[model samples]
Target: MPSSSVPSSPSWHTRVELPSDVPAVHELTVAAFGRPTEAELLGRLRTDAGWIDALSVVVTLATDTGSPVGHVVLTRAFIDDVPALAMGPVSVHPDHQRSGAGSAAVRASLDAARAMGERYVFLLGHPSYYPRFGFGRASAHGVTLTVDAPDEAWMALSLTPAEHPLPSGTARWAAAFAMP
Candidate 1:
């Protein structure tokens, strides 16, 4: 894990989350967040139809290892009947928090979304932390979620600026999100 002032590709490098990485990823997720909540949500996402392979990305200290030092998951969600992505629970082991691994995984996740023809990604996270990856307030882009959150904390990124613009509507996260 490497840390830089601005998020970079990370010296550790990133890869698509594989079945083999699940256990380590779960452990890391729990350790990073100090709770089983995120890991449980990931499990729910995995068994749900919203789990897109490309959306689950990870970063590791070495390519040969199945253990992920960090992870970022994006899942199928809908915005006004158009398909979109919901990003969250981006986790980095507590030991690697400041290391660039988390940022690297996030970058990889966004890149994968664009490559998959996804147009929009929404997230509820730190207002100050996510902008480096080009995220801005979701409301500003006309994207809304079905829950309450601070304006700045709910953010979005438009993958296809010219062809796909995020719309103003409720974002229905996957079943795993369990948003009431």
Candidate 2:
């Protein structure tokens, strides 16, 4: 595992999550959060209409040839009536935390989203941690959330800003989010 401040090594292999990877990803999510809430959310999202199989990413140690130690998901969300994506339930095995595995998974997911023509992504995450991935205040782009969270924790990223700027309006996460 790489430290948060450290860059992920080139040895970290990133790829889309496969059906065979589901169990490992679930266990990793549970281990990372020390709870099943996030994992449960993932389970629900998997069968939901918002699920995008290509946007689920995992990271493994190229050297070890083991199961993925990191995972991330970008599911269907919306800004106002416009379609968008929501990044969440990012997980890295506890044993692999602080290693660059988490970052690699995140980067891979975002890249996959962009490649698939997604333009906007919104999330509630650590302000300091997510900014490194080009996320900024969602409020700055007129994005709002009904969920109870600090102003700074709500962030947005424009995957293709030059072509399509970040949209504005209340973010509508997947039903599984159950945000009020």
Candidate 3:
């Protein structure tokens, strides 16, 4: 049931990760990145205060297999002391990469954040792939990360732009992501 096949506009059901999801998420993170770096990072992040229960979302399926096919995380980060979010380690099982699973998980996480009145979300990820969710160059808004990232790869999205503009300055991610 771990097939990559999904509907054209998949009716993906997403929910917060349960304790049981840890193993599958770790697996998907490793499979998606082809490494354990992000998986280790995720484990550390989970124990940190930045971790928000509602923001660790997974894409649930109708199949009897009942394992999540995708996962995305939104941890508390900051912009010059102002609260924001940092999304990352987003991954869809390689078997489901292009099947809309990733997008569904991300959208669900973002929607959950918005419902919580979160305003700004930032991430260091693919420039081309994230924009569809309303992300744009963080540097364009004068935002930067602690480490050097290509201008275009570091991006932010405003879930409540009219109210809270992404405060400009260094984006302070959770301590787990501190420069090595």
Candidate 4:
């Protein structure tokens, strides 16, 4: 069964992805990125040591028989040896793009991570979009990535900022990410 629903728009609700959601999530991810890369990454992550079953989240339409319309995952990563999370492969079905499903899923996943006592999250994503979730440039706080990405695209969020400050070190992603 899906986990508890998170705050969402009236049209949809967010919850942890059930095992049965695999196929739909793959399709939604491919649709969102217009490529198989991220979808393939999702599959690899699922089998990798980084997979966190409870952190895979989905957004289901309230009026559409509850099929998932969006998804996001927070998986194990590290800053030096300090454990953290890597958020990625966020996806919303093409039809649901720009309709808030993506944001809802991401927010819910972050909330779930916080509830699980996770302290920090890092991602390589749209600087403009992630800042809305309290993400700031990772490099600004001394976090670096082995992968070569635009500086502004690398971001981090300290979920418990007052209690746990962001650590300074190179991000070490899951092996599936192929980050050097």
Please tell me which predicted candidate would have the highest TM-score against the true structure. Answer: 4
Extract clashing residue pairs from model 3: none
TM-scores of the candidates are 0.90, 0.92, 0.92, 0.93
The clash count of every prediction, one per candidate, is 1, 5, 0, 0
Which of candidates 1 and 3 reaches a greater lDDT?
3
Ranking by lDDT: 4, 2, 3, 1
Which sections of candidate 2 miss by over 4 Å? 1-10
List where candidate 1 sits over 4 angstroms from the true fold: 1-10
Per-residue lDDT of model 1, residues 1-180, tens digit only: 886686654468788888888999899999999999999998898998899887899898765456689999999988879888889789999988987888888988999898888888888999999999988998986777778899989988888777866777888898888985
Residue-level lDDT for 130 in candidate 3: 96
lDDT of model 3 at position 123: 95
Each model's Cα RMSD = 4.5, 4.4, 4.4, 6.8
Least well predicted 10-residue stretch by lDDT in candidate 3: 60-69
lDDT of each: 0.86, 0.90, 0.89, 0.92
**Candidate 1 TM-score, true structure as reference:** 0.90
lDDT of 4 by residue, 1-180 (tens): 889977764577888888899999999999999999999999999999999999999998877745898999999999999999999989998888888888889999999999999999999999889999999999999999987899999999999999999999999998899898
TM-score for predicted model 2 compared with the true structure: 0.92
> Which model is ahead, 3 or 4, in terms of lDDT?
4
- Clash-forming residue pairs, model 2: 1-99, 2-98, 2-99, 2-100, 3-98
- Taking the tens digit of each residue's C-alpha lDDT, what string does model 3 give over 1-180? 687965465457889999999998999899988999999999999999999998999996645236988899999998888899999889888888878888889999999999998999999999989999999999989987778789989999889888877779889998888752
Structure candidate 1, residue pairs in collision: 2-100
lDDT at 21 for candidate 2? 94
